[model samples]
Target: MTINGDGIDNPYGKVFNQTYPGRVILSESTSRTSFAITVLQSTGMASDKMAPLLQMTLSHMSFALYNGLAGPITIFGPSSENCDEARDPILITDWGHRSAFQEWERELTGNPIRPQMNSILINVIIDHILVGIGQRYHVVRHADPKNETKFPASENGNYWIRTVPAEGCKGSEDGNELDERQGFLRYEPEEKNKPQLGNNFSWWAFGEQPLWLNFSEPTIMLLDEKKEWPGDYVIIPAENRDRWVYLVITAPKTNELGNNRTFISLAHPLHLHGHDFALLAQGNDSSQIDDPDNSVVLKFDNPPRRDVALIPAGGYLIVAFKADNPGSWLFHCHIAWHASSGLALQIMEREEDLRKTMTLEKLQQVNDGCKKWNEWFADTENLWSQNATLFQDDSGV
Candidate 1:
């Protein structure tokens, strides 16, 4: 491996063949960002065998970089399958970062900084949705127990808190009848909508035995509206086309019962399908929740827009997007583990319009797909049965 346009010999006058070892600094200047690295395989091996081997390493390096994981040092080699010998050099080019915000500003507005004005502000709290056995431990029934700020209690005496499960019936591992409830991470409106506690309610519990047990079907939860049940998925309706929608996603600080002093915060890389959103602000200040509009700085002038954004641990992220796309889009956590464990929701934008566009042929295709999946699921070998070999461990994202 060698830096393009650089001398083959080392700075110490040592003639290095096939490899050059040195520090290559990428300056902050935009012009200095674009550069090339050439890799040459000195071995006279068959191109077919060497190309795949070298490509495998390159692919792994690229995957590591994409996932923000530690990767191998910058290096490359020539292994083109078309080429017979290793004489052919492979040149890898680095295209410097493309400034989307800057370009958008230059094209639309001359000002670089502008405040974002939105029509609707939606606050979404993202955190661990945990459900546990109500009989095993005591669930906090109030946000402020000392102040007597009692949360609406479910039928089984458990509080309708965001951190613990609501009351309901659950089957124990020993086949004994036990009561279950909604856990942390549920739609807030459900707490008030159905204040009357019921006994038949059940919810998904994470990290428990009978791994596949307590699975909940996906449902969309709408803001400002009464939810039919707790833990329903969220839906964002586009009543007007191209309306600005602001989302304030927060990851509240959580504490366990045994260790109430230590707060648990986790990072979530959230991804939104069908549209790009501007990241207005993100930080570790929970106080901004009181006055999100005034306290948090909003970026309007061509702010960075992307499908995926990170919600920092014990912090919040503000994003805004236009509700122009007419489809059911999934807004979910990018982390595989979290997403699988039910850290996801659906956004039904312009459901009426989307339904209008779904023709008979499209509907048939969807029905066929569902039929195939059901057929596959019905196969005893595919399901978790007494003689079944396969078991579902992760949330089928």
Candidate 2:
């Protein structure tokens, strides 16, 4: 891959790739550092199955790490833990440790251990190194006079939405909320609301199976604040396709019902499938943009744009994206398990326009694929089925 810096518009005098390689303090390669990751095998409760023991252990451990610490890359926003200067690399020491990692360990292994060290190395071989000069970029708000648009503060009508984490029940007996199973839990709020934790609760929009393939009945629904939360489905009207929509995801200390099931807040690297969003604001504390006392400051103009942005543990993230794409787009936590457990939602923009773009051939292809999948799933000899019970335990995405 070729790297160049000639296209940069250096306004501020900050370090950047002005020529080719950015200013390099050292050009020589250092000795390789190697490390080993030791996995501890342990026996679980009597009811724990050996088949899923390893997978569960790894999943929980991975969640613990991701939910506990921040990385060296700087996050865009005004916050205590984030670097003072945007684009600057955060110190490894500044990535503080949270007790949540140990909490997860103790719950899984019956013991808590010290935090493990982590690092990544990229090796590129070259005879000589070239350095570039520094460039500058200023942070400007949408209403600022320095901004090209010079939009008025009143015109900055950023559409705001919030979500909270909660534990949900997959199935229950006798319509009892207390008898609900603990297998299905959501790490992020489903859509704009918590997934109903009840016996009657099915996946909010698509039920138990995938819905995108069912083109005949595309899920088209708008956010409703009255009746219930829109679980995994939200519609963006065609008129607002050009407007900027903002979403604020905060790691609350408690669930929607004010319950303490999730005692510690976890981190999530939120990702949007269809489009890159501007990370307008973020903070170390769990605060929303609408919070009256929230000290988090938002940068509306030329904010750092990204497809994946980190939501720090016990913190908040505010992102904005134009609803120009007319299709069903997924916005969810980057963690695989977290997403499968329902920490995701679909943003169906301009439903009518999106439907018009779907061709009959594409619809037939999707239906054909679904038909084959259904047949495979129902086959008696399929490995996914055992004793007439589907072996798939997690939410069938």
Candidate 2 residue-wise lDDT, 1-397, digit = tens? 1221123222222112332122212111122212121211111111111111111111122232233212121113324343334333211110112232332233322242223312111122112321110101223223323333454432344322221112331212233322112122222344111223433222212123211212122243222124432332333333476888788777764432222122235556676655667888877777554578756788977897666677766778889878777766666564434444445666666666766766777667656755665676555686422573423322322
Cα lDDT of model 2 overall? 0.39
Whole-model lDDT values for every prediction: 0.38, 0.39
Error of 2 at 146 (Å): 39
lDDT digits (tens) for residues 311-384 of candidate 1? 76667888977877677665666443344434566566776677677777876755565566557655666543
Off by over 4 Å in 1: 1-238, 254-263, 291-294, 384-395
Q: List the lowest-lDDT window of 10 residues for candidate 2.
A: 49-58
What is the alpha-carbon RMSD of candidate 1 to the true structure?
Answer: 25.5
